[model samples]
Target: MLTPVTDIDGAPFWEYAAQGELRVQACADCGELRFPPRPCCPHCQSFASEWRRMSGQGRVWSYSVPHPPLLPEYAARAPYNVVVVELADAPRIRLVGNLVRAAGDPLDSLDPRGVRIGQRVRVVFDPATGLPQWVLERA
Candidate 1:
């Protein structure tokens, strides 16, 4: 299992995901939210922070379908779609994840050709990875 490295600052994120919730670190002082959790707030340099729950609704800000020569773990899913989802509540907060068919599905479960910029998506917890993945919302 190639799980994400859970560092001191980012461990809570994975914890939340394991609980089936999407959360991001927010500056306790300025209420500014940030991803890839850090010790200090980038907005106000506040050392105080807290995890805030997210709506889990976002749009595909961008996407990419990787070609060959990928890392060994990803090579098997070479043609999978990776998407940057811009959170609806906090547009500035974008998260990268694989767009899959459903919760706990494989990364390459969705067809690459089906992904599109600006497509609506919703978060889903992948129990296998203990992470938040995405699934396209029905129109």
Candidate 2:
């Protein structure tokens, strides 16, 4: 797996994930949560920020499956579904991740045919990458 690019602003998110937690950046003053952690808050333009832990529960908002002419690096992971998950804690904050059948399952392990919009899912950290992956809440 490719190591995620991390910077001063986003490092905390990965650090939290390394410890089996899912967190998002929030404006310390406004208390608004944001993904893709950045130095300044978009809502209030505040440099003061913090990481907020999430419930890790969400609903599938949308999804996509790449077809023919797959990239060499992803050809083997073909037939996988990339889902946009709307966080239960912050409906406005959506995340992109693979919708797997179970925790630790390969990206392509879940049958795309079985995935449905609004399906409930929870976060699971990959042991190797510490990157959060999504699994059906009740697989």
Candidate 3:
């Protein structure tokens, strides 16, 4: 399980994630959606915001494998996969997360080399964090 750094703008997103729901900030004014929670909508610059639940479905917009483990905490889980997922519900927004338990093994294990672009993925949750993480959307 990965611990998130919570900020004023991002806390709500994590809270929702902990509840096994994927939520993004939607522009209360123009209806534009965004991730990485911000004070205002990037499209309309609206300060108003609300939570919109996602279908927990998306595609791998981009991905990479980190070599030699970037942090000591991850050394044990080396060669893990990190992905920038573009949600099917809102293409403009992408969520960055590790693709853990998508196939097998611990979620923290790093194996970025096995990932592919445009691959279908789905959300999975770790009970330890009570958050909606990600996994391969199996056929």
Candidate 4:
């Protein structure tokens, strides 16, 4: 039962997700896209930023399956996947999220065994959390 902690820089991300849109922060100065939103751009140190909608397409860059000793809330969902996805629009911008069966599905809905690095996935907003998740793209 993880919840997003909204901050000055990341609030807009949650706001957009609530509207079913996937957006990332881009530096207004250098036009560099970044994730895990922050007040200043790492590349240009710019305080000015804008939210840019993404194509909702990316590939799994890396993943992990948590084992035991997990928090009680997450222990029941053991073997769940946590993936880092590299956005197709901005390869350098990566977002961490779970792989779900569909929009609004639970984080552990998909079997961990099915997740693979480099697998293409699309973004989906979870209505319950007003946050983004991922779903494998079909051929």
Please, what is the TM-score per model? Answer: 0.94, 0.94, 0.86, 0.94
Q: On residues 18-129, what C-alpha lDDT tens digit does candidate 3 reach at each position?
A: 7778888888999988877899888888899998999989999998776674677777667677789999999988988778764334645535666899989898766666
Off by over 4 Å in 1: none
| lDDT per model vs. reference | 0.91, 0.88, 0.79, 0.90
Supply candidate 4's per-residue lDDT for 135: 95
What CA RMSD would candidate 2 show?
A: 1.3
Q: Give candidates' CA RMSD values in order.
A: 1.1, 1.3, 2.4, 1.2
The sequence of per-residue lDDT tens digits that candidate 4 reaches over residues 41-86 is: 9998989999999999999999999976888888877879999999
lDDT measured at residue 137 in model 4 versus the true structure, 0 to 100: 93
Q: Which ten residues in a row have the lowest lDDT in candidate 1?
A: 1-10
Model 2 worst lDDT window (10 residues)? 99-108
lDDT of 1 by residue, 1-139 (tens): 5587899999999999889999999999999999879999988899999999999999999999998898888889879998999999889999999999999888789999989999999999888888789998888
Better of 1 and 3 by lDDT: 1
- 130, model 2: CA deviation in Å? 0.9
